[model samples]
Target: MIVQQRAYQHPHQPSEVRLVVYETAAAARRVEGMPDDAGYLVTEEWRGAGKVIKTLGFFPDRTPALDVLSARAQELEGQLYRPVAPAA
Candidate 1:
């Protein structure tokens, strides 16, 4: 289950991007009743003029996912990438 989501836009690009953070595997099964083999799946979608141009996926622990997202946001020069909130 996606616990949080955010949208971003780069200053130099015409694309709008989205970042989605999913719940941990254990929480997924307990909360959503879905079995997730991957520890956590983070996804980024790049859209141009309301159309998706590219999509990237990463399966990493929560910490690594934050690092990856920060790097990606910097690389894209996006306006913002919200920090991940601690899971309750």
Candidate 2:
């Protein structure tokens, strides 16, 4: 399930990408350095019928995660990624 999510519009394209933090049954096996207690994940995804496009990395904490997203978000939006609710 999605624990956190944000969206960004492509400055030149007709699509948006989401920066998401989520949990899954096999979260531990997807990446190395993922602490057993983190229980959360971040990925680079393509929009679809709720499918992940790729695994970026794992984070034990969120601060650094935001930093990574922030940099990418700034390029398109000139600010941090805007928070958005996950689709149900």
Candidate 3:
């Protein structure tokens, strides 16, 4: 099973973070297969034990994915993150 949570912030909130969890590759794959608006997908594998288990998908970039999550965060009590353009 996968669970999503909002990242914590204090003092001055810089950006918002949303957690998308998955237990199996199939689940992660489903999320990956989701539309491009689901943010950039970064997979992190657990290798502490001899057997490899669990893969996590992190949508860190501010893309369509961020837009979708940002809305959800706002509704679910998540911090807001606005992406700024780099200075030339």
Q: What is the lDDT of residue 27 in candidate 3?
A: 38
Q: Best candidate per TM-score, number?
A: 2
Ranking by lDDT: 2, 1, 3
Candidate 3 residues 1-88, lDDT tens each? 3333334232355433333332233234544445434335432222222323232344544354445544554643533333333222
Query: 1 or 2, which is superior by TM-score?
Result: 2
Better by TM-score, candidate 3 or 2: 2
Candidate 1 lDDT for residue 32: 48
Worst 10 residues of 2 by lDDT: 79-88
**Candidate 1: lDDT over CA atoms?**
0.57
Model 3 clash pairs?
A: 37-65, 38-65, 39-65
- Give residue 31's lDDT in candidate 2 (0 to 100): 49
When summed lDDT is taken over every stretch of 10 residues in candidate 1, the lowest stretch is: 79-88
* Clashing pairs for predicted structure model 1, backbone only: none
C-alpha local distance difference test of each model: 0.57, 0.59, 0.37
Candidate 3 TM-score over all chains jointly = 0.25
Runs of candidate 1 exceeding 4 Å displacement: 11-14, 24-38, 49-57, 78-88
For model 1, state the Cα shift of residue 20 in Å: 2.1
lDDT leader: 2
Which of candidates 1 and 2 is the stronger one according to lDDT? 2
The alpha-carbon lDDT assigned to residue 52 of candidate 3 equals 37
